[model samples]
Target: MKDKFEFAHGEASVIQLKDISASGRARLLDMAFARLRFSLFVMPVVSVVFVWYYGKINEDYRVLIWSALYCCAALVTFLILRLYREDQKKQSSEWLLITWLPRIQLVAAFHGLGLMVLLPMVSHTATIEFKYLFTLTLAAIVAGNATHQAPMLSVFNCFLIFSWHCTVLLMPWSFSSHWQFIMPLSVLYGIGMFKHALTSHRFFVRMIWLEEEGSRLAENFKLAKNAAETALSDKNQFLTTASHDLRQPMQAMGFLIESIIRRNIDAGLKRSLDDLKQSVRLATQMFNSLLDLSRIEAGAVDIKLRPVNLNSLIDDIALIFREEAVNRNLDLRTWNRKEKVFVIADETLLRQSITNLMHNALRYTKKGKILIATRVRGSCWEVGVWDTGMGVAIDDKEHIYSPFFRNEHAWRIDSAGHGLGLAVVARSAKFMNATYGFTSSEGRGSHFWLRLPAANSIDFSPQGLAVNNLFEEIKDFSRLTGSCLIIDDDPHVCVAWESLLWSWGVRTKCAPSGALALAVIQAGFQPQVIFCDQRLRSGESGFDVLRSLLHLYPEAHGAMISGEFNSRELEHAESEGYLVLHKPLEPDQLYAILSRWLQLKQN
Candidate 1:
């Protein structure tokens, strides 16, 4: 049984009073009480008809009195039942006894014997017509009680017994020839209906038990759903906190290393430092990608759809990630780089998607070559990431894009990954309305591709534009002279940021909090750019810090820097036209922003 009602073993052969759960039994009793309301109305009316029809010929005042008395009893029962249903309903749940038998036999006796008394009263001094009237009415009242009140088995049996006693007391031949047949037939009707009431009572109780059971299950399901949501929320919070903690040190290391590598250091030491910096940067990237997957799913990522230079975008990605491939001692090569490709895309989403693909290839590939290439397909251009990594098994192919789901072979290779790389790719591809697919042999390797519609506006060659961009970039970077303010509670972060900005030909001041940043502004320091951390150790918000600093210097271009990739604060800022940047900010990304700000200042 999927769900079995707790039924106690008792003396009764047919559905014992104790043979069900307390709540189940209470539900059955509630139905019995409801049916009593209808019975109260019917019984009074039955008495009225009996008195009106018989009073004309007999002129019996006693019958009228009895009728009045019965009607009054019904009225009183109606009021009591109504009050119980409305006010005492909570108490009634406890009325299901240890055996689930109610203590309402007194009430049942009063109602049933009230109808029973009428039959005997009429049969004694009445004609055959009056006798027929009383007998038929008594039969109807008994049948009605059996049909509705059968769940209360003890009450219904009392009703039948009282009626049977009346029939036996008037056993002699007092009926007309036409009505003589009804006397014996009433006994048989009672027997048949008695058996029916027994069967029906059990079924009625079973149905009530099932209904209560279903309600209990629904409540349980609701609690489980709430618990699951809370757990998922906690998991996300834990990841966010962990990411924030890890990024603080990485940000310091990133800035300090970049600052050191900028000097004329030995080539061998510079190369080693480069490797360490790349490792920290990639670790931060992986965590950000995981957060990115969540943002795409939540519909939080803003799609900046535009005509993007595919060749330029891929080359930039290739440049940033090539160090990882070199560290892995793997051949990382790009093909058709000069095809001068262009496509309609969200650059961030497309870049993240391709980066994840390349990351997966790097993480899994132990030997051979990994190829990042472009192929012109029918009506679309496909970017493919091919590798000689361990491929997905035939069985695991279907769930390859599932978050945190990893196959045995893949887990064996890289257990550190939460298996979110492909998930990010799938979600990004879906959001961009692009088609992505993959092919792999279990032992050999895998090839993943994202196919995007080729842009119609491919008039200018990216190579010429690339040359002009290089010249403009160097000029922008070299002329990067401005006063910048950085607000962060971490001491190392503040010092490192100051070092990196000062090296970029920009005068900088780093504050441990918003108040300090304000103090710096008040001390005659006017900043052109502001970078504030979202969460500070002093519990002050980056937004609050920016507002205060900007109030002092309204012309400053401020942005919130956070380890959280898609935090609600950053999303709100982005939507409101404020700039937001992620933590462990790559030198180029920060320099690019500063370069643009400088160019704007010059213009």
Candidate 2:
């Protein structure tokens, strides 16, 4: 009842009105009664005008009597609305029957009485008056009973009776002389009523069918939701296992790279070594992307709101995709607002959204252009990215924001994407309370736009410093000496982890399940650090093995790893005295954590 009903559906409106706020419903009822009363009061005045005009023409008294009777019926209708309004307040069925039912019966009796009395005066034939008045009596029965019970049926019958009267009136000699046309017209009216009755029956059937369809749709939605939840859970488990296993090889790779740099080697060999190191860096970037995507989808990423420079964000995105654009022979262009504009948003998420857009643009546009632009529109700042390439179809626009929903067109070009780019962008925009939408025409191009509230608190003056300089103070620790224990269920994960770590010259021991890891640990072997996956095969868990290690070696430092971005389990692990690591762990992140741990030990 609190929700407005101005543009609501008919059935929704009826239900809403049926249970409206008492004061509002009373006011509405009073209004309806007032209109009915006014109509009844004006009837005599209108009838006098008509009577005066016809007084010189027919000199008949039937019109006056009929007009008076109609006025009386209108007064009864007004009283009925008033009584019904009062009936709404009374909960006792006995009170409603004692007061309201009698009033309705009296109204119906009056209508039947008037029709019987007036029709005989108009036409002196008992048969004609009897037939017409009987029809009116049937109509009155429908009206008085229909309003309170079986209302749709009552209303339908009312329309049928009125239609029959109008059709009889239209016959050539119906009012004056010949009763011949009455027989055929009566037959036609009966046929029409039969057809209407059949239609009413069909309406009920359709209503039942629609209800069944709605229930089926609701059931399907629940199943789909559960399936999506299960898939996400499995993905997170894999990521956790992979991250723990990967740390071993990444640590070894860093150790090897650092050791090689200190060796007595020529410049050419060192340069080749640097290339290998860069390849590791690339792998680390990919690993970070996977983790970031997982965390964003799992809603584990906490967004912090701060004043962000719109122009700077767009420029950074354009720069990131510049090489890709150039390689594809696409022009990468950017335009900024004349004045510096700031918006309150999460800068990291904003950057990620823009980056996704730029990546998508560059990926699709082979020989055209990718443009990033920003402008002030009324109260909002609109940031847009456009790509001139094979555009999206009209039907694909509605589904583009769904997770893992790649358009057929995008799949044709490159099917490598997991279809999460736009989904991330949409989620980020919603979290920031920003507006996001895209426009695409067939065979032309696509343009995506995000509008955010312009913020007044941020400093937008250019710093004239590149983002690369932001990390200049960060030192590299390529030559780290350590041994690690990696536990995971997946063999491919173990292979990748070991290779990455061996490249860094760190010794490693890997076990596919926690039971096997426990067996190895019991034989008197322990690494400097231990990394265990949360989910292991054979119903054995990393937490179980880690607990066993802690009991055996009380001073051992351990980290629990998961591929999933869901941090609830990780948080629980951290609370239980374990360092928690997210899956798809980057080489840099692994190095950073190990470097800090080693430094603490050395100190």
Regions of candidate 1 where Cα sits further than 4 Å from its true position: 1-27, 34-104, 110-144, 164-199, 223-246, 257-275, 293-373, 376-430, 433-489, 498-580, 591-603
Could you give candidate 2's per-residue lDDT for residues 323-437 as a string of tens digits?
7788888889999877777776776578778888887777777678888998888888889999887777888888988999987778888878888889889988999999999
Please give the CA lDDT of all the candidate structures.
Answer: 0.71, 0.60
TM-score of each: 0.59, 0.45
Global fold similarity of model 1 (TM-score): 0.59
After superposition, the stretches of candidate 2 with alpha carbons farther than 4 Å from their true spots are: 1-324, 332-352, 359-426, 429-478, 482-527, 533-557, 564-569, 597-603
Pick the TM-score winner.
Answer: 1
The residue pairs found clashing in candidate 1 are 17-99, 18-99
